[model samples]
Target: MSTAIDIAALDPASRDAGAVAHYGDPVREQRLLEEGVGLVDRSHRTVIAVPGDDRLSWLHSLTTQHLEKLRPGQGTELLVLSPHGHVEHHAMVTDDGTTTWLDTEPGNGDLLVYLERMRFMMRVEPVDVTADWAVLSLVGPGTDDALKSLGVDEELDEPDTLDVPGAKFAQGTQPPRPSTIYRVASLGDKSATVAKFGAGWVRRVGNGADLLVPRAEKDRIDIPRAGLWAYEAVRVAARRPRYGFETDHRTLPAEAGFTAPAVHLEKGCYRGQETVARVHHLGRPPRKLVLLHLDGIATDELPAPGTPITLNERAVGFVGTAVRHHELGQVALALVKNNVKDDAQLRIGESTAQIDS
Candidate 1:
């Protein structure tokens, strides 16, 4: 039997700075990710802790999601939108009774600044805990088995009810709601917290969980490791939109397919509620996010992000993230004009892409 590899001992070439890009074989990593639980190091992501008697109410007034009644151990996502309804920042939020923990993509200093400025007379205090805390994800059908191996046997509560009003633009089937947070008494002698979120494309790739543990204890957890390459492949295949990858300064919640889970339409007045309500009630967004299957591209020859997607030499949209999937050949997520036909054959450089049905 092959022994479990320690991710901390990986060669420098296999990692991009601190994040593991791959483990010498991206295809094999992707296969392992699809077939069983693959441990992904997400320590580079940012973690913010908001502690106060007024944390929930203060957050409810500033963000797009309804959070005034957020119960402890309940997890959900929220978006910070510009006054014009443009997505500014996004975060995965959960409360642990005393403190509300929010994990988001790195480079979210602006989000912290905004939160500070919004605390007029509120009793909330938001602090950056990224340096002390680290995030790890267990992704695949075998997540429970892997957790069992680590001596974690906590039972998760059912997800909170997500019923809210004014979700008309949240078309198609909504993805699963975020999982309840569970406290793990020990993960190899280290205490940690686990929750299920969209870590591995929760819609298509279910049975995923995230571990929030102290940075010092991350290297001690023994498990087979996968890299960000495998995580991105599964994310792209699931048609899930990420913050930096699928969103830009001009992105609306509905445009990037975030209206369902990230936006609580019937909530009381918030920063960008007017625009979100107008767009939802009036007409379709200017652009729509879609998954595209790139034809005939080698693993090493995939197009870089921001590559222009065209139709008949006319630029229509741009690519976000591209990856080589284990089942699907080459696939990418793109934001195209809403008027673009569903059957339209688009081009990214010389490669032709068909919108995945």
Candidate 2:
């Protein structure tokens, strides 16, 4: 991590979930991300390769999203659920004709194991490919323009030439909403730069495009380095729920607000489809996801995850994630009772919070 970030002149390293935190001036970084292009190191993400004749179909049957119409260059999310409809694993999936790539959070060995065990009688094979590939993200309003300046367009296509041998790239998300996904055999080589591969693959996400590249080539990429701090700020303002933090082993798609992005209500039978449907049609989830607007000046430290949230002096929910947004200061994502009124005031570890939903 140091080797890649060192070249970008980022300092005061902090760690978030075992991934390097950022460079410096998170506020400035986020400002740039909202107005111009900024780079964020995403080496901590894990990648999986599903290769076989039935790869697409098999995965479609197992995940929350429909995969039959997922064309090359198109990217969307997938959620692996327990039989009871709890979100167990989440992945961002993309297919490039021969192989379908699943990019997920760190420590995906368990997810891989679970997936491999379900491959009975199918030709699909899931392999952990994080060791071979790396990831980086580009954010900001100007990100898409910057990639176009380098030659890669919004169209997903393999460049005839590349800086690294056997390198191919498609569009996807590493920052939840990303611009591209690059696949390369090796990263030890020094000459493998993002610019050498038609700059990068570009896709449109919210206001910017995210670029994915090999970990070793992160320093080689020419984008300005932004850190996790900036990423968090933008994500919170966007009201996006993270996997392990906001959605977890006990989280249902409805509770995490993933009913649209990650769940297909009309998709065919899946492990937790019954519960998902039942919850949508018959009953409400025990809890519902909400965004919180802390009613005070921003503090040096934000509310910690799992901090108890109280309503009328009684615990009603807990904090999941929080960020001091560049625009909306001291924002957080929380889970509260489905019965909690939107206008109700709450408390998070003594800080008064109100539903921002």
Candidate 3:
């Protein structure tokens, strides 16, 4: 119910060309993302609880990922699509069997509520547990080493189960000491390691990091420089889809670049299962999610979020997210027509990069 991490103290960075936001602190989003890695206090994301006898089976019938195999201390990402298979929400869940916690944007809360309402007919009980927990994300180059030093062993190559800090769920590994470990295979050069805790300890855990006198003085983990905006740019570069951004109720998985391990086409009948399988096997996607590089696109700059993408003098797609890159120049993720998707030359008033197939 109460936000454990203070957003006011955390900086707010704009998406403007080279902006940055750290731990919530305001900074150049571009610098934060490219030059230095950062920590993001993603306390705002909501968590919903699924409990009861049919919890796994109940959710198995709703979400797009395979739920039967995920154990406690483990988390997996998923796309909750509308019947037509367009993404309605992108979800990451950590389950302990007894309670499967869904972590997603607040915007997706309505969908969770809707699913829960429908669950009234089943044995699983859905409860809003957003107020019950807090989460912090670490990203960028040194992420793996940082986590490995923090009692989490990265020795395991897969998402395995672990019991840590009182939660048992699937994770990437189990060190001599226990903790939940999830893999973030998004960004090209970066990865994410999420450490979660109940609302009561979120603050303590966050604050505790500052006091840790790791003999790791040898491993220069710049925990301080790593913040939210930097992490945002990383997501943009990785072309990792964000809810309410690249995806929406009308955006299909194929069109939004949903190629991650999240969606299991072989998984039997979920709400949008019919469309998911059909599209991958036989149907052609209407649009293509692309990464764009702009060169003086706008007299001022490239448009943000909803700016229309123009190729060959016609509107092809919309700019999902745009940010200035330190080295790569202007970069963006756009949704263009499937036909010209990869062939189209991106032209934002002259700035351009050919889409690579």
Q: Which regions of candidate 2 deviate over 4 angstroms?
A: 1-15, 154-203, 296-299
22-48, model 3: which lDDT tens digit per residue? 433333534543444444555556667
TM-score of each: 0.83, 0.81, 0.71
Of the two candidates 2 and 3, the one with more favorable lDDT, higher being better, is 2
The superposed Cα distance between candidate 2 and the true structure at residue 203, in angstroms, equals 4.7
Q: Per-residue lDDT for 245-324 in model 2, tens only?
A: 78646888888877666776666799999988778765578899888988552456777777788988998888888877
Q: Number of backbone collisions per candidate, in order?
A: 0, 2, 33
Q: C-alpha displacement of 293 in model 3, angstroms?
A: 0.3
Candidate order by lDDT, highest to lowest? 1, 2, 3
- The residue ranges of model 1 lying beyond 4 angstroms of the native Cα positions read 1-17, 157-206, 296-299
From the highest TM-score down, the ranking of the candidates is 1, 2, 3
The C-alpha stretches of model 3 lying farther than 4 A from their native spots are: 1-20, 23-37, 153-222, 341-343, 348-357
Between prediction 2 and prediction 3, the one with superior TM-score is: 2
The lDDT values for all models are 0.74, 0.69, 0.55
Give the Cα error of residue 287 in candidate 2, in Å. 2.3
Candidate 2 global CA lDDT score:
0.69
Which of the two candidates, 1 or 3, achieves a greater TM-score against the reference?
1
